[model samples]
Target: MPRNTLIAGGVLVVLGVISYVASAFASVTALIPAFLGVVLVICGLIARKKPMLGVHVALVVALLGLVGTFMNVLKIGEVFAGTAERPLAVVVSAITFVLLLIYIALGVRSFVAARRWKKADAISQA
Candidate 1:
């Protein structure tokens, strides 16, 4: 999961850089993904030392990322319909949303499995 976090962060950083460049550096807003990616990278580094703390923080960030981008994700239809005001931004947001969502899902799965394993261990000890 730590590795995955780092990878996701790397991807987001790239996405933001590309978006910013694509906009000819006119829109600082295009760097939103880069900011988020930085946070994730930090979390990933922390997780390397403390998996529980790091992953939980990452999950929270991912949840927030999803919420922040939900509206933009909805704008996908508009982009496809050629009605989106800023198609590139919308696409970037949508992509970010997907990445966060996937991370959250995988994190939740990992959490559940860990919990079950702990419970089983406790049962065996008892």
Candidate 2:
């Protein structure tokens, strides 16, 4: 329920909507971001009461984003190799990559906060 987690979730939801719109013109594969966005929103909402769960969900999403971005980067050459080039595809890909990085940052931050909270609770109880 930290402010940053809420902001991050909101950002992800917006980005997902943008990705869905972009997918209309690009490729069906673009749906990945939309899906991730939904998951992030759900996690964020749940995180308000159960931050540990949210942190775990965010970490999983971040891992997925990392893998997806890596694959996209590797396939960039193949995507542009054809003469019938599509600039929009490249732009979408770049945007996705950036969003993924943001997701990772948010996930890491939430995770660290959750860990600290656990440690503090243990110390207080002890």
Candidate 2 C-alpha lDDT tens digits along 1-126? 444555655665676667667667456555655666667777777777887787577667757766766755555666567632554555455566777677677667756887899999999999
User: lDDT tens string, model 1, 1-126?
Assistant: 898898888899999999999989989999999999999999999999999899889889989999999999988999999999999999999999999989888898888999999999999999
lDDT of each structure? 0.93, 0.65
**What C-alpha lDDT, on a 0 to 100 scale, does residue 38 get in candidate 2?**
66
Best by TM-score: 1
Per-candidate total of colliding backbone pairs: 0, 0
Worst 10 residues of 2 by lDDT: 83-92
Clashing pairs in 1: none
Q: Compute each candidate's TM-score over C-alphas.
A: 0.96, 0.64
